[model samples]
Structures are given as C-alpha cells and as structure tokens.
Target: MEITIWDEYYELLPRKELEKIQLNRLKRTLIRAYHNLPYYRHKLEAEGIDIHRFKTMQDLKHLPFTCKEDLRRAYPFGAIAEPLRNIVRIHSSSGSTGSATVVGYTAGDIEIWAELMARTLTGSGASEEDIVQVAFGYGLFTGGLGAHYGAERIGATVVPMSTGNTARQVQILQDFNISVLCCTPSYALYLAEVAQEQKVDWSKTRFRIGIFGAEPWSEEMRADLEQKLPIQAFDIYGLSEIIGPGVGFECQARAGLHVSEDHFIPEIINPDTGEVLPPGETGELVITTITKEGTPVIRYRTGDVSSLIPEPCACGRTLTRIKRIKARTDDMLIIRGVNVYPSQIESALLSFKELEPHYQIVITKENFMDRVDIKVEVAPEFFSDEVKTLEKLKQSIEEKLRAELNIHCHLRLMEPKSIERTSGKSNRVVDLRKKEGLT
Candidate 1:
C-alpha cells in the first residue's frame, strides 16, 4: 500500500533539521508559559529556571514537570497561556476522578491541531474520496470535534455522528456508504456485534478503514475486530491534555505510531524516578507541545505507558514513533502482589476462539485479601453447551489467565451479550475495594 503523508516537508524532514525546529518551538513555548501562565511562572521562578537561558533541548530536563494535578489546580483558565479574549475554544476532562482539567485553544492552536489530525488520518490511509463517520463523543470531550475538523481539513466527507444510538449508527454505516469509521476500539467491536445481530452484510458497506482510539487496546483485540468487521483497524493515540486524538498515529506499516514531532516532542521516562529512558525501554510517555498557543504544557507527564521506537519506519516518515499504549500508570491493578492490566487479561481471553470480545475485571477484597473475578461472555454456541463442558471451558480460561497474568483469578462465563456495552470508552475494570472502604 502507498503511504500518504499529509505534510511531507515536516513529516519527512531530516532528524537534524527537525530537532532545530523542535528546539525553536520548544523555546518559544517555554517563554509563553513562563510569562503568561501564573502556575508555570511561579513553578519556574521557584525552581530558579530561566526560560530565556533555555539554549539547548537538553535544558528541558531542568524544567518542572506538569502533572494532571497542576492542570486541575489551574482550573478553568489558569494554565491557558493565551488570554481569554484570544482563546476561541475550550475542552475539558470528565473530572470523574477530581476537578476537571480544562484546556483552551486559540484559533492558531486549532489550526495546528487540524493539520496534525489531517496528518493522522492520512497516515491511517484515509483520503478525500473516503466518506468518514466520526462516532467519538463531542462537546467537552475532544475526540469528536478534533476528528471532525481533521476529516474536513483533509477534504473527506465527514458524518459527525457524535456517539450513542447504535441502531442509528449501524443504519448510517449501511446507508451512507461510509468508507472510514472513527471511534474507540471497544465501541467499534460493539457496533460490529450490533450489525451482525441486525444481519447487515459487512461486505456490502463501503467501510474499509477504522481509526480507533480514546482507550488502550491490544493487538489480539485488533485481530478479533478484523475477523468480525471487514475493515483495516488502525490505532490513533492522543489525550485531551495533549491536543486530543491526533498526537500520533499508525502508518500502513503498523510497526508503531508516528509522533508529529514538529508540533509535539515525545519522551519515555521512568515512571518512578522521572529519568528519561533509552530507546526501546517501556515507561510513561511525556509530551511537550511546542506550537500550541493556548494551554502549552511543558514536560507534561501523560500517564499512558509506552516506549519510543528509534528505528526508521517503512512508511518513510522520519518522525519518532511510540509503541501502541497497552497500559497506564494509573490503570495498573495490584492484586495479591501481582501487577495486572486489563489489556493483559483481554489478550488472554481473546486468544480463545470460543469467547466473545466483551469482558470485565472486578476487583474486591475478600477476607482482607485482594481477589480478582473476571466476567467474560462466551460465544452463543459454547454458552448453550452442557454444564460440564462449560465448567471445563471456564477452568481452561482461568488457567490461561493465570499463565498470562502470573496470578490466579476466578473466571465467570457469561452468556452472549450479557456484558453491557458503551458508546464511548469501555468500563472494563470495576474495583469495589474503594467502595467497600478498604485501603
């Protein structure tokens, strides 16, 4: 397949030239944050860090790290570098954990975002001839609008079907002759299930490419999705804190996601000590947005865990690539001294042919000990089998999970479509220990 690069000039720039551009933008962003944002200004001044003296890219480490907590403390407008008058748009987190972290964007920032997202779509094999359907949630969430602007910028026909109403979405998929679908990976699976239930022929639709993000997924899930849906699934990585879903994307090579280094710098650091790790070492991802005019974050610690791939990609883009995110620092679950991620369990479950793609991890405290119970849906044919056979399959799944996770866990086999589905990010883990007032 021929690779499509939206901005060949920057995307294909030599490493030395790209670094020069990154250095300049990095300096400009540091100055903007230091002078305009009070939180950043105070942090810099207290640390005795002089933004003007930022002569080299290495000086970035001397600066303080920006965490989600800092953004929350900044609240509605503290972190915004540009004045409110210049800020033309606002997007925020769900604040389900604490206070919502609000992000602002100037017109220039939006333009940069659109350009990056256009690059994202093009890298994922989208073109102007494709009819794109965006199902990411709109409004406060950035996924929907961010993708919308990018599809339009690339001159692709876009259907802004902002999440929910699965039936309507399936109908549009069948009627609109949509060529590209954009949404969370889990939701894509749900859509495929619904379409199958409705007896819609996947080969009849024009859907060919699926750009999935807003949540971490596994390659196993990708294979499952491809098997069920007639589309090439591509992973797009981004967070609202770092300009939504266009930070990076996978090329046709599918080796790793190419970070748009001209606009944002990517780094992998030890999550515990904050030490920048060497290439190929997995750690938390840190991003610095250089061209952002509004909420410019310096060394922002994105909790997502991934590694930097230093090798050149077959797609010929020189931008740095980060491995697809499979786990997050915040999402790690410690059960009986064993560290487990939902993706690990998902991979293990998907390896079995008799199981469906839907599953949930429920963590609770039993007798002051952490107990993990996984509930997964079985294929209809298997679900209707004799009890003895079902028990044997359940034991086999438990053993598979134990071998994969390195910890024993109880497995509950559920009937087909027993687990509830979501139109947005899937709720795969439910930790009842917190609700039970257990530490």
Candidate 2:
C-alpha cells in the first residue's frame, strides 16, 4: 500500500492549475509549429485556422488531426520545428514499409524526456537505492534509451542489458540481484521462463518492481508476471512520437495511467469518425505534444485504443488518466467479416487456467473467404498423455473462443514451450489475408 508521488509540484497540481499550465505551454507549442514547421503551417492555413485565435484548449479540436501517414509524408526532419543545429538526437520507427516516421529531440527535449522517465520509474516504486536492468532494445527503437536515461536520471545503478541474450539477461538478473526491471511484458514473461530454465529463483532475488510497456498487454498477463516473479508489475506507456517511454505511466494505485498533462494533452476520439468522445468512452487515443520543441505534433493520432478517466486518481495525482491501451487501430484484425483484436483473443485464452499466456492468432484466406485460427500452448502441468483429454481440452478452448469471439475458429493446441518467443514485442497476430491481397 506504499505510494510514492514523484515531482509533487507537477504530479499533484490542482486540476485547474494543471489545465492552465497545459494551455500556456500548448500555445507556445502551436506558435512554434506554425512559425517554423511548414507542414503545420500549410495544414493550418488550408483549414483556415488562425493560430492567434486559438485561445482555449477546446480550440485544439479545430486543428487537423495528425496521423502516422502525415509523419511519413514529412519524413526525417520535415515535421521538426527547431533548427537542425538544435537537434541533439533522432529516432525512427522500425516500420516495415517505405518511409519511416522520424522524430527529433533537442538537448532540452532530451532532458525533459529523462525527467518524465524519472517520474515514471519513481512512481512505479523505483528509487536511487535500486538497481535497474533495462532489457529494452537500443538504437532507433526508443524503449532502451528512454528507460536507460530515466533510470540514470533517478541516480539508480542501471544494467544496460539491451535486448536478446536471454541467457546473459538471466545471468545479470541473478548476479546483480536486480531490483527493478524495465522491458516489454512479453519479454518479462519470456525472462521468467528463461530464469526458471537457468535455475534462477526470482523470488529469492532483490527484484521488487517491473515497469512493462512498448506493447499492449492485459491485466491477466500482469497478474501472471507479478505472481511468477514475485514482483509488482506496472504498465509504463509512451511512444517515440511523443517523447518516448515517459509520456505517462501507472501509479502504484494501478487504476489507470496518469498522463503528464503538463507536457502532453490526451484525448479519446472515435477511430472511424474522428469525433471526440466523452470521457470514459473507449476509442482511439489522440495526443498533442504541448512542450516538445523539436517535433511538436498537434492532435497526433496515437492509434492506441484507450479511454480517458476524468476522475482524479486515488493516488492524489491531478494529472489525467487513460485506461490501459486495449488495442491499436492499426492492430485490429478482420476475420470472417468480424473486427477482432489480439487482446480479445488473449483475454479469452488467459481465462483458461489450463492454457499458458503464450498464444497466437492467425487469419488467412481460404477458398475466397477468411479463416481464423488460434494456437495456444498448454501449461506444463496441464499437458495430457491421453488423446481424449487433449481433444477435450481443444474442444473446451474452441468453445470458449466461439463464446468470446462469436465466430468459429480453428484451435491448435501446442505443447509447452512450443510457441516461438521474442525478446522484444511479441508478435501475436499473423494476418495472411493481407499478404494474399484479400484484406
């Protein structure tokens, strides 16, 4: 029941004061984009938006929504508002397409990023006395460096164990007696398996806190990780386009992620119609970087599916909270004329105690129609020797899928440790329909 509030001045600011601060910073951000970035200027002009007339936060809706395509159109530095000389670092998405979405950070921007990350880590019960092991990948991917800098900022001893090297990662965790772990949830679970294989008892170690993000995960997975590792697992959220991995994070309260409203403004909108939905309504989460200097975005569509909770957090933070991301708009899968998300499938699978959290959803084209299949591994104790028992388990899984997904899907029961595991974000969906040009 311990609660730690980092940056009490900002984190505990009154709602009215926080909004006023957001408004002021937002004005400066808009002016910077309108005056420096031609893309924003042109878009504003085309929409007949008078930047000067933008007085209230409500006026932000009048501005056009910035999407990933717009970032792609702008390419490397086109969206940047600062001079190239002021830019200190650059990061781009690992998009498997043509142009990558590039983001720039000035020296000040980097400092702010580190500070926000510090808040994220500290809020998750990390402290200066703790040893943090960052397993996120470095380079163009922002997770590694973002968490790295934040750990450093908090004056914690950070083990810069990037990604991969599962054996080595387990060795560090054991030898260093790491107290804090920051990485994707899937990787955390994978590490749990690796640690077990290496005869490393996480409960005996100093491990106490886990900051997991960079991919969407379920509360079921969180419970699994916490129980498996005997640690408190928290969701830390951020995107490269929005100052990396410190845009917001879940406090010890664990109700929702408290956004750094002083820096970024969050809104939930209907993904299909672009209409701003009321608070508590599930929709696509949109954000505006109100304090970014290098590449400030206006109403940038995050494509992350979440809802805004207008009520104050029990942790006493006035910052707005957004429910954990359910699914991304781009991550949705259409199977048999039904829109499905991998989270839905994960939720259904996790409900079964006999099934392991490791599962995959596949959508392929069959005879001019879409076919849905789910492959889930059985827990070690739940594995059966009898064919009848296996078939019964499969039938039970299929029945659950049918009840949850409302459509028939092929169920492939896998043996323990049969499914491929990734050191980074887990690829849960395989849509062969897109490959067949049938989407």
Predicted model with the maximum TM-score: 1
Compose the digit string of candidate 1's lDDT tens values, residues 255-323.
899999999999899999999899999999999999998899999999999999999999999999999
Q: Cα miss at 71, model 1 (Å)?
A: 0.3
Q: List clash counts for every candidate, in order.
A: 0, 0
How accurate locally is residue 73 in candidate 2, as Cα lDDT from 0 to 100? 89
Task: Report residue 196 deviation for candidate 1 (angstroms).
Answer: 0.2
**Per-candidate local distance difference test:** 0.92, 0.89
Find the 10 residues in a row with the least total lDDT in model 2: 92-101
Those runs of model 1 whose alpha carbons end farther than 4 Å from true positions after fitting are none
Cα RMSD (Å) between model 2 and the true structure? 1.3
Q: Please write out the lDDT profile of model 2 over residues 1-439, one tens digit for every residue.
A: 6878769999899888988999999999988888998887888999898999999989988889888888898987898888899999999887853568999999999999999999999898899999999999999999999999999999999999999998998888878989999999999999998887777766678989999999999999988888788699999899988888998799999999989999999999999999999999999999999989988999999989999999988888888999998789989877777888889889888988889889988888889898988889999887778999989988988898888888888999888899999988888888888779844
TM-score of 2: 0.98
**TM-scores for every candidate against the unseen true structure:** 0.98, 0.98
